[model samples]
Target chain A: MIWNERIECATRDEMRIIQSERLSETVKRIYHSVPYYRKKMQDAGLTPNDIEDIDDLRKLPFTTKIDLRDNYPFGLFTVPMSEIVRLHASSGTTGKPTVVGYTRKDIQMWAEVVTRSLCMAGVHRNDIVQIAYGYGLFTGGLGLHYGTENLGASVIPISGGNTTKQIQLMEDFGSSVLCCTPSYALNIAEVIKEMKVDISKLKLRVGIFGAEPWSEAMRKEIESKLKIKAIDIYGLSEIVGPGVSCECEEQCGMHINEDHFLPEVIDPETLEPVAPGEIGELVFSTITKEGLPLLRYRTRDLTRLHYEECACGRTLVRMEKCKGRSDDMLIIRGVNVFPSQIETVLLNMSEVEPHYLIIIDREGTLDTMSLMVEVQEQFFSDEIRKLQELRIKITKQLESVLGISVNVKLVEPKTIERTAGKAKRVIDNRSI
Target chain B: MLIKQLSVFLENKSGRLTEVSKILGDCGINMLAFSVADTSEFGILRLIVSDPERACKVLHDNDFSVNLTEVVCMNCPNEPGALAKALQILSDNQITIAYLYAFSTGDSANVVLKPDQLEECIKVLQEHKMELIEASTLYKI
Candidate 1:
């Protein structure tokens, strides 16, 4: 079921040659077209000519999320606006969003890689895929959509949310494959149980879950609850989206789309490549991307790469499930949120003290964020309505900034815990 | 007349109310009238104490978010329609009441009312011949 046997099962030497050629071309294009990359390379005392092969990847400077934020909307795009056929964005640390563009050929390449990923999951042209990842701006929905279509499979295109309707479509359309976040799959499973919908009657057989880090225990829970084989998919919007890697039926580790996205695991401290099979921050270089091709982009995700051949017969390197993040970024309901963002919102409001605590918990397959804020003495009111109004105001401000509703609990002053001299900001109770 | 009511912010957890009462009692502060306004997560305990300044200071030293709020206290006969008649005066003058609570003594009941306009509420109630208790008198009682 491998989509491209020549690329998927290529010998190490053959793959290295392919990577060398693409890496050289990408380096040359970005150096000439993008001033940011040119300046970065110039500061590093390296030129496109210095990058001759895949071996020279470490010599190139690493691009981080800060670089993307600095460029903002279109400063990093190597191609012109007309050349970009599609655009997707995810939340940045602060107010602005990190945007990525795709040219026509880039989109085609995306579809190809995702198509290959679906094949790795045993999906064929006859399979019906119900895409539940959110569409528009977020990469999960449209990325899987194009890939599923490229595979010649029937796409339900049922974007995220609306659990009852998703269940109804699963039964009516006889969808054999489901694509969504792992937590949403569990949520759907709970709805199915509550509604007493017979899971045995549904034609669903495989679920490809991604866009958030999940655990092995959660995978077992989703698989047993939904009566399907849950495959973990890995991708970030900064990379080429969900098609970057996917797990095979063997379910050992997700197969990295090495031909399209060159994968590396580096020690976060020293920024040096870790020993094989050692967990480190995952990095990617978009070798074939035309619109927003990145060179040695540092993806803060922490995971190890396995070079051994998988039972699924694909030579593409496999990455173990992401353990955690190198930074303090949290993915709540597939939305990237930083504690600093919440701090910024709290600091702007005068009614509440700057001291706040964020508690993340999972209630019935959904992530819930409870923010405990200390009420300021000047804003404390005897009237219940005024206090309620203050709570609602803080909640609204937080939701607007974080793009997710948060449960704001107004507590008395000095209630949030402080250890030594520093205040503890986040308390995550979720296992994943 | 306006009475200084101490309002304390309390999380809806066991032993919090008891702790506040214990702290005030230990400090020899007598609570004249108290009302609790609560939601699911937290509660606001409003108290009229003999030594409000001392009670507020002790509660503040104990790390409780306590503040002073001015509320109108009126003395009404301990009859069924006594509260209704006093409230009718404010209602006729279009004076909105935010919240009200009462405590009965021997022959009359002391009603604590927080209205939208404090000065106008006092003038309207006084114009209707309502008995407005002074803060010192209420605190002594």
Candidate 2:
């Protein structure tokens, strides 16, 4: 296959030369317009001039979720609220939701980044893309909704939750591309099988699954079932949503749109920056966003950065598929096991449903993980002996995937609760 | 004429039925007739215990979600088509079987069914042409 050579061939010196000036201008804009940025810079004893180059980004104070909340609504916005054309927010799981705003230019830039991500995943104007993510304050749906439309593709805005309806629309409308959370994508695939909706008969060519964390095993399963390319998109509502970076056709790493968003890996423990190719929290700084131009925003997502050019000709910074979050990491048996890793293995198994709950409990001093997985009706045996056998298989899979042995409980169909929005996969019940 | 005293909701699981059984057993309440209506989420544990008020309190105290029902318990023989003939009676009166379950003591099987679209299955039984057995008759049996 012919690789995208132009982007790959761009000299590092030239890329840095471009990122420096844009980064400098973004720093100046935030510092002048938003009081939050002014205070952050003042406390750090740094001026916009101090951030002369990308290397000087360390001299700047890091932005965080608390800062966003402190500046609730639009206080942190660089532009006036009147100029903002659109706004989005995160799932707001902890407390209040982190909202984002987009100006007319920012919306165009968002569409551009999403389009770039889609192109790397080999989507085209000829494809009929289905948007299944939530389309409200949550950015997953609307971001992709606009980007797919902007790309000139025939858009099917099947805003999530009604799996049967999504399947019907996919088949009836000849949708060639699907975008939703990874778990939902797997769910739609299951419904397609039960409904016997011929995916091959449909026009689906590629799938961009994101919003919540997923694993490679899920990607592989979705690919086989839908018989199309499955790619992961990375973004948070604080920065933008579902379009900061995306998987290239090679599916190795997600190509970050370095032109708009600059990514950095920071030592979460030390609050200092780490070199590329090291696992650390991924940080991003938006250059062209009007509503919220985050400078050195701590994404809290753990991943390694790759500065290499992609097969799809895009001169952008790239990051590996995120390993897991620092907060959600379960240190069991001297190893950190991500629930997504366990999920990956389960999705690969034919007997398991993608719907599962990672129940974290304390057994003595060590943390114990019990995977509550749903089985299709046929394999759901009530006999404890049969359930034990199934549990053992899951335990082996977990040990192999996560390098930690965990107890797997085979739950009956629909035993695990389903969420209408982002699915809550992990239930850490360690406190009580 | 009599009414089935109670229909309690219980989850269909290992210790669920055992827990309910132990509650009534410990309360010194004799189950004159009892049956279970099973489904995926939960089952209705219908009973015509000798003292339903005491039985309801015992089961409720044990955390079993209970409901007071007035179901018509029909005594059917263990012979072929015995259930068919009894069910034909309800069908002839257009009484739908919401759910039904059976439990037999030595001689007769007490089948409890909640007729369809009726607030209480007792009123429907009164409308039918069958003789209703009362609590005393159930205790004597």
Candidate 3:
């Protein structure tokens, strides 16, 4: 079932050889064509020749989203505008979006990697992939679209919204492979229940969910609800969209496309590499990109990398699910609160479901955090004392885990607004 | 005798209590008696209603966390010493009352109370020969 067996299941020595050659070529190309990267390396007193292999990646200057922002629209692109065939940008709420461009070969490489990703999820040529990721400058929709086509699968490019339609088309089209953010998948599952569509009737057997960090609890919820094997896919617009890596059928860790992308885990504080299997910020270097190949780009995602062989028979190095992004960590009254940590606590409790919103507001100079949790149908009843006890129990568990007392509010089922994309979990109203 | 009481948790908002009462009123469920317990952030509304299950259903459907609890009700003589006599019997029997509220009706006063030990309080009341109102009779009233 391995899509690109030579690439995905390559031995460590073979991958190192391919990565070494690609890294050398990419570093030289970007250094000569991209002035932004050239100045960065010149200022760091290094040359493309200095980066002879993948080991020399540490010697290169690290590129970040801020660096891309400084470059703005096409300042970081290594190719001419005429040569670039496609362009995509990360959704930026504030100012300039992080722009990415691809030459024809780069787009082909993107398709190849994503084709391999779909194959890892057991999607075949005969399978139907319903892509719900938004199409446009956001790379997810089109990236998966082309990849599904490349894999010879029938793709339903039903891009994002109109939940009822998404479900109807999914059933009518007999979609076997579903691609979207995990939160949107959950929203679809909720709508399916609301519409009383029998889940057993749907042809979904595999799901490729990503674009935001999700937890094991969420994976379990999506899998059981949709009756599919939920596989986590990881990518960014900077790293050639949603096929930088993917979890195989083993469901252990995501196998990074090591031949095209070099993966590294570095300690966020020290800016040094962390020990194997230790958590740190994930860094990637695009070795085969043609349009805007980057060198040592810091991803800000926190996760560990495993190099061992997978039971699914892929030797491609795998990365564990990201804990959270460094910037996504919320400091609540001097306590660190990760939405994943709260998710972990909620998923362990039987009375409450994993759907929740963390609201942080300020009173005078102090900060206050409130958790709005949905009570399960079996848990929600006419027993006020039991509800109060459940609320208190959740509050205590959250307080113990977060080291700050959280005001737990019991909300009715499905009261929270479900988005067709990444779920907004934290709302800090201190500024407003 | 045990009487059913409905307790609801409400956010400390201006129109929260009104919303609960309005929903109950619209459902034609009459509140026989009720009490409010408040903290800085939230409040609990304990009610003795004509139909506990129906009132609870209506309030819950309106998104209120509601519960039903069994409370002891007693009929005391509507005299100055009548209340003191009932309290003395319980105090002597070592049965503590968590909370109690009384309303006078004609010549008799009905007092609803939550006791630490329901069986002990009832046995003490019967031994003292105090009139205990049956829930069926109270509901009819």
Q: Which candidate is the best by lDDT?
A: 1
lDDT of 2 by residue, A1-432 (tens): 112334334567876776788899989998888777898799989888888888888788888877887777788988888899887765332334567888999888888778777777888888898898877767778899788888788888878779899988888888888998766777788888899876668878889987666667767878898898899898877788878888888888888777678888988899777765889989898866777889888877899988766665555677998877755545442233555566667778787768788887755323577877765543543222344567688888777656546777654445578779978888876532
Per-prediction RMSD in angstroms? 1.6, 12.2, 17.0
Q: Which ten residues in a row have the lowest lDDT in candidate 2 chain B?
A: B123-132
Give the better candidate number (1 or 2) by lDDT. 1
- List, residue by residue over A314-413, the lDDT tens digit for candidate 3: 9999999877676666644323356877887888887777889989876643468899887654565333455677888999887766656898887644
1 or 3, greater by lDDT: 1
In the order shown, the candidates' DockQ scores are 0.79, 0.04, 0.07
Q: B107-136, model 1: which lDDT tens digit per residue?
A: 989899999999999999888899999988
Cα lDDT of model 1 by residue, A366-422, tens digit: 999999998767888898999999899999998988888999999988788778976
Candidate that would win on DockQ: 1
Number of the candidate with higher TM-score, 2 or 3:
2
Fraction of native Cα contacts kept in each candidate?
0.76, 0.00, 0.05
iRMSD computed for candidate 2: 11.0
Model 2 clashing residue pairs (backbone): A4-A311, A176-A203, A176-A204, B1-B132, B1-B133, B1-B134, B2-B133, B2-B134
Q: List the residue pairs that clash in candidate 3.
A: A384-B67
Which candidate leads in TM-score? 1
Candidate 1, after superposition: displacement of residue A242 in Å? 0.4
